[model samples]
Target: MCDSVAIIGAGNIGRAIAEGLVAAGSYAPAEVHVTRRRVDRLADLAERGFRVSADNPGVVAACDTVLVAVQPQALDAVLTGIAPRVEAGRHLLVSVVSGASIAAIRRHVGPDVPIVRAMPNTAVALRESMTCLAAEAAHAGALDRVAELFRAVGATLVIDEEHMVPATALCACGVAFFPRAVRAACQGGIEIGFHPEEALRMAAQTALGAAALVRDRGRHPEREIDSVTTPRGCTIAGLNEMEHRGLFLRFHQGDHDLRREGGVAVRR
Candidate 1:
């Protein structure tokens, strides 16, 4: 494992990755070098013993693994600025910026530097993110290394680069969708007589339990859903009502729109 990392653009996702890595004992606070244009925004990290700076090139030169977390609009400038310092054999570039492909990044940093693209969602802060990773076949070793890094935070899946946009929709955007579902459940609970706080606790835990059943048991979600839904029971009734309201169609449409938008964002 690399002993140090430079997280460029230490925004929300970047900060989450930094905190998760340190909290997991994978890296010490001092080992993580974080950078932002406004260094004052990183005062908390500086106080926590992280090497904080606004100097992109300097930070990249100091770390072996460069994790780019900048927004798409800022990516070009950040990569171009650090291009001079990136050495092919000495550094690995792992990017969490949505839509920017390895080829696009390679253009800025040069062909020899291995680039891995990853998408980790909102749940990353809780160390429960489902991160999707991709790299060319020639960079498989780098891909494995990145996978190991992400596993310290949550699960990881390596897919073909072509599927990265859809992965963003399903895993990254899916975190937000699941919470909306939980919110709906909480609303239903309130209607059924539970107080707001009690309803939220029950709904969120139920959602977690449902996900765990599918994950730990390695069963299909439909199979798990079937287990709780007896023929004439309320469970089936609620499910049938949701289906009647086009739940499946709505969810599929939501994913499709997000994937489409992600592709558009990358092109821009």
Candidate 2:
């Protein structure tokens, strides 16, 4: 039911949100507007029929919803620049910058404008993200719309804004880190005498299939794991080896230590 959406940055997260919003048919690509200094990187969006601009103010002034997607350090400056151009009840600000809070945005952008704090990981680009949503104190429905908007691209959950930083610490950053863990698992498969390409495919597909088991089976993952884990069978033997190496437990529970060695960002 949105007339237009403007994204204040053309970074990966911004692109994902814009693409999802437009692709979901809530609005057309022509109704989507994007701005960034790097004009070249916007070619894909431009080709998809979005209005690409280098002027954030021009874009922000024209849209019903505006997404602030700059880096955390740049958020204040971007807010300051766009504050005056945005009038009360005309634009609702949706922020995706990590670690920044809505109270801070209200202090910088004035009190009347509705504000939403949106946190989504890089998986958004693939339409498989898990996004967290929050709104300025007492500004209801703002958060719901934001959550629904993100649902077009991926799954979403609503939680207190105070939880966002830790949620970000756990998931947003972990999402990037999770892939490296997957790659490491694939490498381990290769070291165990499986051909590299075959091992990678098998590892990736196994992970995918395992996840689907939870979705398709409508039960906990361990239940599915237990289903195939017969007493002392080849699967159990392999399971025993994996358990001995801690790989089985670590890989599934999103283990912290195994993740740290793989370059997981635990904060910020």
Candidate 3:
């Protein structure tokens, strides 16, 4: 079993990781420690048996590994405050803060510490996230263990650190993008005579099944599209109409711009 883990900032993603780890049987609730300045915000976790506190240094001192999930602006203070407690050889540091480089963290925590950068979306709460991980070659062993921990909650992909910006937009922001697409489909179903609740369920299940086909069968999206669209069928007609209306074009161009611009800016 993995040693106790301390989540430095138990916000949405951190809390989700804690919940996912426990739900997956990777860690017992008591084995996880969570921290935030406002301890009241962590009452739910406290009730669930997780060690909750407002003391960052205390939590870091007790745990073997640390997952830093603080906002980019708060990172410097958090790292500096806990630096004294972050043991170089004994602790593994995994950061999920977008846009913060490993070198930047090393400045505060020192160079001997093993650090891995990870980006996982909110779907982690449901154990269906697509998490991206990256680390220096020297920290491969630590990275492997981090990967194993995430794989218990969802799938993991190892990618170059340079591509982490695009991965943030594609994987983290993607949770929102897919739901927007599903919402449009649900509206369409409602217009075609289905009740709101019925349309929502049908549209959601269809989206789920479509994603499963591509993921499970390893087939290209266009191949699946071709399989369902007969030359003169309504499916083909709707697809052609959508293409002519620039649905894919608009979404693609916008995403391309975002990626080129270092994937959405991390607000101060």
For all candidates, the clash counts are: 0, 0, 0
Model 2: per-residue Cα lDDT over 94-133, one tens digit each: 9888777788988887888899988888777667788988
Candidate 2 residue pairs that clash: none
How many pairs in model 1 have backbone atoms within 3 A of each other, for residues 3 or more apart or on separate chains, i.e. clashes? 0
On TM-score, the stronger of 1 and 3 is: 3
The alpha-carbon root-mean-square deviation between model 3 and the true structure, to one decimal in Å, is 1.8
Candidate-wise lDDT, in order: 0.90, 0.80, 0.91
- TM-score of every prediction relative to native: 0.95, 0.85, 0.96
Would you list the rank order by TM-score, best first? 3, 1, 2
Tell me the alpha-carbon RMSD of every candidate.
2.2, 3.7, 1.8
Candidate 3 achieves a global lDDT of 0.91
Model 3 residue 83 CA deviation in Å: 0.6
Predicted structure 2, TM vs. truth: 0.85
Worst 10 residues of 3 by lDDT: 259-268
lDDT of 3 by residue, 50-106 (tens): 999999999898988899999889999999999999899899999999889999999
> Candidate 1's error at 261, in angstroms?
2.6
